[model samples]
Target: MGESPHAVTSLPTARQAGCPFDPPAELIEARRHGPISGFTHPGGKPGWLITGYDLVRSVLADPRFSSRKELMNVVDFELPPAPPGEFLLMDEPQHGRYRKPLVGKFTARRMRLLTERIEQITTDCLDAMEQAGPPADLVTAFAKPVPAIIICELLGVPYEERGSFQAQIETFLNGETGEEELMAAYTATQQYLAHLVAAKRAHPTDDLLSDLTNSDLTAEELQGIALILLSAGFDTTANTLALGTFALLQNPTQLAALRADPALTDRAVEELLRYLSVAKSFMRTALEDVELGGRTIEAGTTVVLSYNTANRDPERFTDPHVLDLRRQDGGHLAFGHGVHQCLGQQLARIELRVALPALLNRFPTLRLAVPAAEVDLRPEIADIHGVKSLPVAWDA
Candidate 1:
């Protein structure tokens, strides 16, 4: 409860130059000082930043920390509550209400069922990349399309509508667009989802969205749920694919190890998830005065759980900075922890498991077309961290 001297005045934004995969150096330094550091949010409210693995995971699983959007006290102005069916920002029963129905749909077994289809998608993408010859932007040719198509099919979106749908979602999440463009993209997505949900109600199909239409959820709720699924399902995995490939090309030893042994794919994926931590930080507000990492989190205090730094905490993983494909210590918070953990994590794992190795096998000589430093990375302000365009080449 006593005042600590190591309060970070502001959240760190810039990652160390040329080290796209690591957390900002300031964060790593913060962790070295202690697991928890006092922090001041950009909006001028005081809070805490949790950088230790144990502390970050504990906060995620703790009921005392509320995820409700409106409860976040870091900002001066009161925030609106999350929309219906957008469970990520809601707590307890409301969160469970929206999440429970989807749990059965995204279970490991259910997701694995889509493996063959995902494999086909990955293969078809690689085929296009090959046909186009060398010097292809992997983001467009392979990474983006693979997840985009899979998610569209899962939501039963008509094949003809996917191209525009994908573009709109990209604009919504890319984080670089102006406020006007961002809202326009979001509005377009919402409108489209409304139409899609109505179509599903009148004529249900075998897809996840259609199945959800049969539930007690209304058209508006279904639209919200579909929006969450479509955005989360597409963006995170897409970034991981593009950024993971860039990471591998940078770490030839790890990539070569995976190439040498096919079984390493699973471990490699886990390690990559840990190393990249592309989704980055999440926020939680203290419901009551609580002690965390020897500090008192006052009631209504907001804390930023730095996932990337936590995943790299040396106490949690030995040599945490190194990307070891064969890493066995696998409890990383990339997909997150607790009740609100990512719903599509299993699907993501399957996509990465199949796509990365397959891409490697298909093009044994694949490497970045530009120099490592020349690869364009998404801005730190972006919700997802990844390459804007991963220009890659392979022997034709």
Candidate 2:
């Protein structure tokens, strides 16, 4: 293996001031230097940071690089294994065990079958926005509720509780909440899911979680699985819709292309997913020594895969920084790659393909209600990056 590159000690938190959609300049620079670089986790344990597109994708597909949470050696203290069904943090056959049963649930065909319902939900949101008049905070009015409602239905969560459940999720993910608030929200969600799981066991319904009850999975495992699905399903797509709209409004030419040709919708959705890549970085640990990008990842070492940078890597994309709806390039890591790739990706695609155009078509004059700079953004430390509230307006 080649000599390791010097470590970039800190993970970047600041995006270039005006470029909210871009990865931090430091990360882009790191990718330019080399695919793999040395790093020190905030906890002071040494690790690798993989920023290049090819390298990130390669590492994600490598079984020698484990995803087990307990195996992550980033900190000195021992960390517990991921909860029972949180398989994203586990390696196979555990990961495969959890993921395989649910594959049919999120198949492209299954998600596509929900297109009409997604249309109705999108329409309902636009109707509410129209009724409420102009200058609405799109985050609350449209983005958050659309996906929140869908995930709740999928999980068999009671309709009436969705509002509070959504709030709790936001509190945990928005990245600015105090520790007490964060813990409160997390505890509430866990308690709610526990009760929800028992309820599903007692009385199965037509929903995905209800269906999973037939599996040998224990209630605790079901709760963990629900938590993963709920968090990933709602948060990622919600931010993509909100932030994608922001990007569209900023680039009117691209927006016009999407609006003018419904045929562009699918391609546009992929581009937006790639461009936003909001669920930024993911960490993996080497189960044994592995050579990647000409450097050795020692056994039990953690590596941070920078998704946003990978999506924007100039080597893999032409004019990587620009968002073009008609651009033909695909295979972005927005939903990730390999076995751990997002299961809900097809569902997310349907949401965007249905929601964005419906939104744009409903309000032709849509534009930001506040100055671009004044739009509140989630803190850089947030697990997901996006606007806190997108204040948007259209002709009354």
In candidate 2, stretches whose alpha carbon ends up further than 4 angstroms from where it belongs are 1-6
TM-score per model over all chains: 0.98, 0.98
Taking the tens digit of each residue's C-alpha lDDT, what string does model 2 give over 1-396? 235554678775688878989998888878788888888887888888899999999999988888999988878898999999999999999998889889999999999899888989989998999999998999999999899999999999898899898899888988899999999999999999999999999999999999999999999999999999999999999999999999999999999988899998999999999999999999999888998888888888999999999999899999999998988878899988999999999999999888999999999999999888888888889989999999988899
**Listing every candidate in turn, what is its Cα RMSD in Å to the true structure after a full C-alpha superposition?**
1.0, 1.2
C-alpha RMSD (angstroms) for model 2:
1.2
The superposed Cα distance between candidate 1 and the true structure at residue 284, in angstroms, equals 0.4
List runs of model 1 lying over 4 Å from the truth.
none
Question: Which structure among the candidates has the greatest TM-score?
Answer: 1
Candidate 2: C-alpha lDDT: 0.91
How far in Å is the alpha carbon of 244 misplaced in model 1?
Answer: 0.8
- Candidate models: Cα lDDT each: 0.91, 0.91
Error of 2 at 260 (Å): 0.9
